[model samples]
Target: MNKDQVKGRIEEAKGKMKEVAGKVSGDKKLEREGKIQNISGKVQAGIGDLKEDIKDAI
Candidate 1:
């Protein structure tokens, strides 16, 4: 995959870890931050996918 895809996947994994850690520590803010990061990662990955698709189409 491209840089964006790789980065996004990494962020997603990190976010998941943070989310779990937050839950264990009972930190609402951390949990919310993790959730937001995870969603942002997903969006980045989607953008990467779209780029790949367009490249292939052309």
Candidate 2:
């Protein structure tokens, strides 16, 4: 719902695409980068979720 959440989800999707592309193209570097990006996105999304929870609890 927030900017972070939206951006993170978008990033996650992009990373997934990159991962798939990397696998198909046989690029280990690209695949690793994608995995990192995906993890980063998940973290960002988690942060957003935490913020939302805190706000709701207030």
Which ranges in model 1 have alpha carbons more than 4 Å from their true place? none
lDDT of 1 by residue, 1-58 (tens): 7888998988898888888889999999999889988989998988999889999999
What's the distance in Å from true for residue 36, model 2? Answer: 0.5
**In the order shown, what is each candidate's alpha-carbon RMSD?**
0.7, 0.6
How accurate locally is residue 43 in candidate 2, as Cα lDDT from 0 to 100?
Answer: 87
Scored against the true structure, residue 50 in model 1 reaches a CA lDDT of 89
Candidate 2, residues 1-58, lDDT tens digits: the string is 7888988888898888888889999999999889888988998898889889998999
Q: Tell me how far the alpha carbon of residue 37 in candidate 1 is from the true structure, in angstroms, after superposition.
A: 0.6
Highest-TM-score candidate = 2
lDDT of each: 0.89, 0.88
